[model samples]
Target: MEEQRVNELKDPSASKKDELLKRRKKQVGGAQGDSSGTASQGEISPEEAAEQAAVMRSQIHLFWGNMLFERSQIECKLGLHDWKKNLDVAVERFKLAGASEADISTVLKNHCSNEEAAAGHEKKVEDPISNVVDKGDN
Candidate 1:
């Protein structure tokens, strides 16, 4: 329901949110959640795994990313600087959503890494400061 609302309003600027929305189009389940655990329990297919991964990544992104979730009912919003705390809550949600243990494991990597951000500021082609003309001198 929350995701659907997020999807409907659709803040199209953020790259992370864009990716998350794209994944939502392909999300599994009957509008419920994710896939369940193991072959015995119910093995998650590749597509389901991808969708579940996206959900985890999306939740983590929303929590730690630049976006403010003041009205968001997402569980991760309460998780501040605590990736484990966020992951724990997300895991339980996914479990209830029917995500398998292996599926959860696949998305359990450190989602808080800054690798998504650029390594350094992109240098402008020409330094604008250097091009400043001294009109008074002229």
Candidate 2:
């Protein structure tokens, strides 16, 4: 059995298999090596990093707000008859529009309960001056 094992170890196919495994290891290790190379490179300045972060935050906020507005519009058109399904559709649309899962949840949590509520909120957002004037003693 020992002699048979030694013979198998010397087989050309076995050597080829070993070569393939080593090549795979190198490919896997190369990915880590590239990341380390990037780490060794210079980092971004603090101000630049802060600016980038601010821009990203603004973009996310804008995306969330737009999704909310769109959701409200959809609710207004579809009415309150299958609200759960409508909210699901709105969430899916938000995902397709590049909203993160957290943003989707936040939007849902802050969403209006029915079409009437959605219309009221939409009107308030779309016409703040009108809302104030209407509330005033004309």
Q: Which 10 residues in a row give candidate 2 its minimum summed lDDT?
A: 7-16
RMSD of each: 14.8, 23.5
Q: Per-residue lDDT of 1-138 in model 1, one digit per residue for the tens?
A: 677534432321244446645655544333344344322324456875776576566555434422222212233444446544545665565454444465445444323332233232233423454455544356
User: Alpha-carbon error at 136 in model 2, in Å?
Assistant: 42
Once superposed on the true structure, which residue ranges of model 1 sit more than 4 Å away at CA? 1-80, 113-138
Measured with C-alpha atoms, the lDDT of residue 39 in candidate 2 is 38
Cα lDDT tens digits, model 2, 27-114, are 5566557855653223544764665565455445445545555656566565756556656665654555445566556566566555
Give candidate 2 regions above 4 Å deviation: 1-42, 81-138
Question: What is each predicted model's overall lDDT from 0 to 1?
Answer: 0.44, 0.55
- Per-model TM-score on C-alpha atoms: 0.25, 0.30
